[model samples]
Target: MSNSDLLDKKLCEKLAQSASLTIGHDVLITDSFGYVVASNDPDRVDSLHEASLEVIQSARKIYHDAAAARKFAGTKPGITIPIIIDSIVIGTIGITGAPHEISQYALLIQQLAQIFLDFEKRQRSTTRTDYRKKNLLREIITYDSRSHDEAAICESAYEFGIDLNAARIAVKLEEIEGRHDDASEETRVHQAKIMECLLRHFDHPQDFVCPQNNTGYVVFAFGLRSIQPQQYLEMLQQKCLCVNSECLTVGIRLRIGIGFFSHSVETLRQSYENACFALKSIHAGIRNSTCLYIGDVVLEKIAASLPDGICSEISAQMFGRVMQAKNRKEVLLTIEHWFQQRFNFVQTAQALHIHKSTLVYRFRRIRETCGLDMYDLDKVLAIYLLDIRHKLCGQSDSRTSSIVM
Candidate 1:
């Protein structure tokens, strides 16, 4: 801990109160620079105490009598004890009275201060370690091997008992309707809770969660034991459902994405990207469903791999006229649902919560506007491919206005 964080005012005041109650004398606490932080004498707070400075500098106790106190600046007759942690002086605790009268309480007050200082130091150390771990995880998942030394990463992973050769999968959790700023305390609390719940579910030493962005977290779960990848994925999906259900009671919902199993740490980045892609592909129509898998969206992933120009051209050629229609968005959404249902008129209508006749009417309008027969396999394939590209590239709104028939 740094000098500024050595002894906070609240802690100092608590210690001062304890000392005053036990020793029956006015007590004061000072920082390393000798600024009084807490004192039984309310007026003495924030005042400079020269005697405490001397005790800190000398690394020894200072006993001042009435005559000696008069010679020192900002001093009263008292016994001042230096507060030490890890063999370094951090602050001072003083019991005000004549040296002879208050000398007996100096050892007790020093011990009490040390106890609080030690606790604070441990807490700070733990917090620092957690931050380092999070930073390391982020680096491993986001940065390329050329940007960081692979050997050093392996060494660090070994220190944490993480096997670099083990199979792992990346799981991402994102908050739905989470528009709060990243720096807000509420967002931080929510992120912490999400991590806490994930850690509770996967309590193995090799499984770890790291914050991905303002609204999401990425979890890496290594196949340490004998669990199969599919089994692990199912377990994670169930855990996500449970977490989402719990959060719903509090008016928050989470969307979870699971990537395919990665064979080694080198491929973890790909897994993380895949997980994020899957999360982004979550359909807004399925509000009750909270989990998605990369394996389930293979066509979308393939579309994402296509060149941007090719995707744009395909989207323009296939959906141009349909997008120019009055109910462009509705038509596009209906087509998307129809493609998702494998062109089953009955199933697509049921999924869209519309009657079969209404669905047929929409399809007839789409055929007329786009000049593509839905019954033809080649035209259906072309439109389906372009629709996949549009959804994966998030070009629904962008292409609607720009593309022409």
Candidate 2:
């Protein structure tokens, strides 16, 4: 919120409109770029506030008298001051009038804007508990187990009345595919609306939601003690499916990963890791499912859990040479889809939109190239795991605090 682009344009407009009334002067607001974003005078909106740059660069007040205004084009004799929030210059506010006449009003407006922004920051703090919650979630998920951070996290969770003894599952939602023409601010607004609706949908007494940067959201849902683990998981699956459908309606395709139920913050580390591993499997293109459980990931979980260097070594040993062989693309596609279909020839052929004979020929080439066969389950499992590891290596690492990206 302290960033330049995060400045609330509508709030600035309201400030300009409401403040202009007090002094009988045109109040104007400019973004960090010196583009007038809001003004009491409708025609002045979106125009360049020439003095904004000077004030912003100086991080101090800039005043232009009538004589200086007469010498400069598109100039108004006024006082412009930078709006600094959290020590970052987000934008500026200006009072358009005679420099001497509006000087007092300029100081008053600056103070008023600062007070308003401070109030807004506090509102976000207490209203949604957003600032505090985001920081806590980051700390809990990113810190090492058995560390001082865990004690702090527990204390903070206690303050929020989150039941540490109760079972809680961490669910992560990421927009895997989508396209939109919305500007940054509009996108932020829409995302906020989506989160609000999701918070309501995932409505449990102890459920807590915090957005992960702008790319995704992490939810820690509780109140699972009343239901069996399987039943609770089923209920969560349905909720995530519904949420995914709603997101699709707005041109967002999402992948949701549900972690295991855990009680303590120390174990929550595994839960968050489980969620990331599940998402990595989805991104690995082994399955087309919108939602996956960490427990159901099977060999993928075992394989993806390996260190990146080991995963790379296994992938290079298993399919790397095969992928570099002749007709590699067809072979790679055939082998991947073949395993995805559980070695069903017809299903693999249909998935690849190729004839059964072509698929057979591709398999023959794969066997010849890699000395591997689907009949050998050990080799096949290795390939399956290595393929997932290989694909995950190319995509973003879900483990390194994906919440921030």
Candidate 3:
């Protein structure tokens, strides 16, 4: 039965008479959240059944005191005897007759309170464990489709006391071709043991580590001192190679996605994207035993990492031209051709499928109309930056349709 159900006024009555206490003789029983579940006192029965600050305040204070005394986490509910339950004490049994009557029953009231509290604690522990399991599973599912970089999620977990920062390597585990459907739970356990052994070299009980997905899995781990992402990738690949033995092609190929520190979930999402991209690029033509960062895969970092001043100036000039151009296509084609040529026209024509002569004609027209050099480095950079800005700004034309008089 529930804690409230167990708190019987009849039991309190019997206890009170047995101990012969005259101290008010009121008994109250309260829930963990401080709602009065049952009580013998009439005045407190109605409003006390609802939650109140007075009840929560008293309950929390008592629980904290018990905790500071080094009591086990699950022991708080039963520790405070005969003080208050729900809100009104269900078993106060105070002595109204004499001081001796009240004193005699004090110990009995205290013991009963402790017993009830202990039972409440056991109930809470069971509930919490169930909740945690569900939450863990939910988080796993949420991340299943995410890129392998999980630093952001791990950082968030750490903020909540989950401690995910250790040297980490991501492991991609696919089931053996023929055995995937038939893989047993025992096989999963064995794999877990293998991973556990790998971690045993560095993991502490407080460390965060786990496998996600089916028996075939991907897991990340952290250790005291982190190895470079590539080294960690190699280590995982080597271990998987050993596990596969001679059947190399049939065994699951391990691709480890490595990520650095991320302080928040947004950064973690970026990392995950990078890792997945790296995996795709690395596996495509160059399946070497090396760690690949997302930035390195397509040289995205280098291309996108324009100097701030250059980027800003380019943006301004491109937009300015776009705003001024009579024909949007003229501006766009000019910019596209300029970059395609590397600011040179002779090469740009061949790339754009236009005649070189036509390209020269366009370049001359662009310079005349926009008052910028087709050969200038700054002008070229401006065209490239503006193109991107125009696209992002969702403008059909970078220039105005009508020129102001």
The top-ranked prediction according to lDDT is 1
lDDT of 1 by residue, 160-212 (tens): 78775678888888888776466788887777777677777778788766676
As for TM-score, the candidate ahead, 2 or 3, is 2
* Reference-based TM-score of each model: 0.76, 0.63, 0.31
For residues 268-382, write the lDDT of model 2, one tens digit per residue: 7678778877887787776678799888887676765677666555556665665456565565566677777888889989999989998788777678876767567676766
* Top of the candidates by TM-score: 1
TM-score of 1: 0.76
Q: Model 3 residue 371 lDDT? A: 66
Ranking by TM-score: 1, 2, 3
* Residue pairs clashing, model 1: none
Candidate 2 TM-score, true structure as reference: 0.63
User: What's the residue-level lDDT of 308 in candidate 3?
Assistant: 48
Q: Which is superior by lDDT, 1 or 3?
A: 1
Model 2: residues >4 Å from true position, as ranges?
A: 1-128, 177-183, 307-321, 395-405
Which is the winner by lDDT between candidate 2 and candidate 3? Answer: 2
> Every model's Cα RMSD, please?
5.0, 12.0, 17.5
Q: How accurate is candidate 1 locally (lDDT)?
A: 0.76
